[model samples]
Target: MVAADGGTDRASALVTSAKFSEAAQRHNFEAGWLVRDPWRASTVSDHFRRLVANRLFVAL
Candidate 1:
């Protein structure tokens, strides 16, 4: 019993997929992926770079 889902249009698919995965007795879980838009990329990258540098080399 294996189940996988990604992107939209997941619900209509779940109805048929649920049967193969033992939907009645199985546990459910929720997970999400991190995404950044082009506009935010530079800012996020700069912040991340500084954060890593600070962690690696502590300032006096």
Candidate 2:
């Protein structure tokens, strides 16, 4: 259940629904935080670029 009082409902839903895979859960949780975190949004561009680069290298 979500900490509806002052917490993230969507994240709660994702958890309750068991949508998070074991290896990916931490990443998913962090992603949820990023979406809700304004500070994270401001700096995520660089992180996204690096992530894309890593993925591209893997794909190659």
Clash number by candidate, in order: 0, 0
Question: Candidate 1 — what's its lDDT?
Answer: 0.38
**What TM-scores do the predictions have?**
0.31, 0.25
Q: What does candidate 2's lDDT look like per residue over 20-59, in tens digits?
A: 5776675554333324343444344345456668885232
Residue pairs with colliding backbones in model 1 are: none
lDDT of 1 at 46: 50
Runs in model 2 with CA error above 4 Å?
A: 1-31, 34-37, 56-60
Candidate 1 per-residue lDDT, tens place, 2-57, comes to: 11232223311111223335564377443433333333444444554576688963
- TM-score of model number 1: 0.31
Whole-model lDDT values for every prediction: 0.38, 0.38
